[model samples]
Target: MIHRLQNISELIEVSSRMGSDINLIQATGGNTSIKIDGYMIVKASGKHLANAFSENIFVETNPQDYYYNKNGDIKIINPKKSSIREGDLKPSIECNFHALLPKKIILHSHPIEIMAHTMLNSFHSKADLALKGMNWKYINYAKPGEALAMEIAKSMKVDNNIYILANHGLIVCADTVKEAERLQSNVINKLKLNRRVLKDCELESLENIVESIPDAYLPNNKIIHTLGSDEWSLELARKSAYSPDHAVFCGIYPLIIKDINQDWKRLMQGHTYAIIEGKGVILFENSGKYLEDMLLAQAEVFARIPVEESVTTLSINQCKDLVNWEAEKYRKKMLEKLVK
Candidate 1:
């Protein structure tokens, strides 16, 4: 008979293991949770998985009553301590999505290879076809938190072990934490094999691309929009190495806007970044900066892997599939707008 998972420690260990195994969560791009008794054990916000131990993992409130603010941050009502308030420690911004899974354990991550496929518009159907026998659901890109959680809840019926967040990442759920970990591994391994098949078809080149920008483009008040002038290097790295396919979808990089006002203006002006296959892309808006940073970091890590260690590249057909998928996405958006 299956044993019930006992305490917070067990949940913490399981959550930590999932974070370690799936290359999706680096530093802290991903979060994990497990239900015990009436409480949910979730990874503490701003805590890195590599260093996350038991004690500091704050337990603020129950999963059922979690709330989302206007900015999409999660707020929990803590009956225990008034100062130890719901929104006090600020749970993972993605906590609501984690809370919605019917399983005891939920894992989410931004795995690079999987993300490479996810960022492409065409890959979801291809991925669905690829994982034909397994039970899963896919939800299109929505700003994270309440909106995304609501969309997933609407789309999913059966308690599938995995959910693919379109243009984002993967979510795995299982009866036990160990089972969830295993499922996550199996999914990653399959995606890795798919990536290898694509990589083997042809090698994309990155020869003779300009690696440096002129001094004029260097960080200045005009250019340093959101991250401040000090983060210029960080911004540059983000633009340079963000995923190639993401460039096609989200633009080369997001524009760095300071506040909502600037963001609104930029969106109105239609000034967005685009991706190039080998070369890096730039970031524009701060909202997408976290994703850009994560992709850039992953690219850097991949760069260190020797050429022989690299898997096969994606094919033109695969690329075209992504483009077609994006077109459909736009069409759907237009239809929605018309309906509105």
Candidate 2:
């Protein structure tokens, strides 16, 4: 037990660093795991990587413990034999591939640098030149969890250690924690791009939009206002491009208010966020930091994308699949309890 927790501690150290870097991960969006003596300890569903050090946010499981049905739902082989920890916590939905992978250490992250390219329509044509000579394969978009794990498993080769998950993020696998960290840093440095600078946000317009929204909704911060003041970013916010966390936390699309004078709240369209065009951004009432980070993450990803690159968005079906997923709902519920 002590040895396992020791391994978990190392993973937490790696995860804590990853969580603190907004450009790498935000809120409880990413997960980490380490395989030890045939047992794997992975981040719990919807738990914050940043809080792993301070909380019991990992679960012990084996690849053989769970299986996917024809309907693609994950099922435990013997629920009665499952760990007591699993009574309230479970491995991340992404743990399927982690357990099945050949590597001993895995770090899955939503890197802004990598996501910038995955969102690009032209990334496939440009990948060879961008990551030439690297052991990386770009996995096409798939619904998260079992489906995504299988997609990656099919594409993986003996030498491929890094995977660029299209419309998703980056995955780096290694045999040791230090080696994993080193590889991740190399990938980030290699793929990182300079963000397109935005002009200063119009404060008066931002204030006006803030006043128009119900008092319950407030701007997360003055920084997110740049998302609305810029025409291109405002357009990007509407779709948020199917990154699983954004869809799960912030909803499929944001409510766009072209004119604040219109009945804005009624037009929310069930979205938790309202991007007031020409003004700034506002969160729905009772918004949590998870949603806040994802909102800013949406803005960050869209801003880094070049204007000419046609962005790929998740299909309506894809968004529906992620938003309505039972596992995600559990994660959201867990996130609130663990992170706070």
Residue 192's C-alpha lDDT in candidate 1?
A: 57
- Which window of ten consecutive residues has the lowest lDDT sum in model 1? 197-206
Q: Which ranges in model 1 have alpha carbons more than 4 Å from their true place? A: 1-6, 67-88, 193-340
Local distance difference test, per candidate?
A: 0.49, 0.76
**What TM-score would candidate 2 get against the native?**
0.90
Error of 1 at 143 (Å): 1.2
Candidate 1, residues 1-340, lDDT tens digits: the string is: 0132235565667556645653566544567777767566666555545444543444444666653334443343332222223343455556676665667778787676665555444565567777778777777665455566777766755457788775467888888767887888778666653322112101122112212211111111111222222232333324322332343334444444333223334353564332232233333343232344444434433432233432223344443444455333442343244335
Please identify model 2 stretches exceeding 4 Å from their true place.
66-87, 262-269, 338-340
* Model 2: number of backbone collisions: 0
Q: Which lDDT tens digits does candidate 2 get at residues 1-340?
A: 4568775667889999998889888877888888888888888887778877787778888755544434334342432244335557777888777775668899999998788778888777777777888899989998878788778767767688998898888889999899999988888788777788864477775666666667436564566776787777776776744587777877777777776676645655456667777777777665666777777777778778776667888887888898888888888887677556
